[model samples]
Target: MATDVTVPTDLWEGDLEAVITNWLASDGQAVKQGALLAEIMVEKSQFEVTAPADGTLTITQAADAIVRKGDTIGRIG
Candidate 1:
């Protein structure tokens, strides 16, 4: 089974979208649960996205992609 890595809906308060700034884990890389996986920027503020489970990462959204809250950016399986 795969777990979806999503941007938390409560990460920020507003309707403004965020952009994926960097991917800390490469595609297909094995990651532990709670490991930092990516960075996102909302205006000048930056946030870290963490792995939801221990598995191989599969990026669904690339760096520089604009994403909204609750968007699934990757999967772990």
Candidate 2:
């Protein structure tokens, strides 16, 4: 089964959407749980997205893509 990589709903306090700044792990790459997977920016603040479980990463959203809190940006299987 694949684990959904969602943006944390409490990452920020505002309603402004975030932008995927960079993907630290490439698609299909093996990763461990809690590993940093991507970077996201909201307004002027930046945040890190981590792996939900140990598995191969599958990116569903690319860098520079706009995203909101709780949005699924990738998966791990």
Candidate 3:
């Protein structure tokens, strides 16, 4: 199974909207736990979202795209 990159609760403070700024890693790229996977912008600020575990990352959202807090930005498996 794959994992979803849900927006961090602290990042949005209950807000479910966010904008993707950039992806540090390409789609389907292998990543280690705690590695920076992408940079997200929420509430007018930017933040880095790290991988929770080691796996192949598949991006479900493109850069500059808007995503909800619980939206599937990508997956690791």
Candidate 4:
């Protein structure tokens, strides 16, 4: 089973959406749990998204895509 990688709702203030800056890991690449997977930007603040489990990365949202809290950005399979 794959684990969903969603935007963290409590990482920032307000109801602003974040832009995916880039993906640190490539699609189908093996990633360990807690590994940095991507970067997101909201206004001037940036946040790092990490892998939830040890598995292959499958990105659902590409770089530069806008995402909100609770949105599934990728999966760890």
* lDDT values for all models: 0.96, 0.96, 0.82, 0.95
RMSD of 1: 0.6
- Candidate 3 ranges with C-alpha deviation above 4 Å: 14-16
lDDT of 2 by residue, 1-77 (tens): 99999999888898888999999999999999999999999988999999999999999999999999999999999
The predicted structure with the larger TM-score, 2 or 3, is 2
Give the range of the ten consecutive residues with the poorest summed lDDT in model 4. Answer: 8-17
TM-score of 2: 0.97
- Candidate 1 lDDT, 1-77, residue by residue in tens: 99999998888898889999999999999999999999999999999999999999999999999999999999999
lDDT for position 3 in model 4:
100
Candidate 2 residue spans exceeding 4 A from truth: none
Put the candidates in lDDT order, highest first. Answer: 1, 2, 4, 3
Against the correct fold, how does model 1 do in TM-score? 0.97
Candidate 4's TM-score: 0.97
Candidate 1 regions off by >4 Å? Answer: none
Q: Cα deviation in Å at residue 10, candidate 2?
A: 0.9
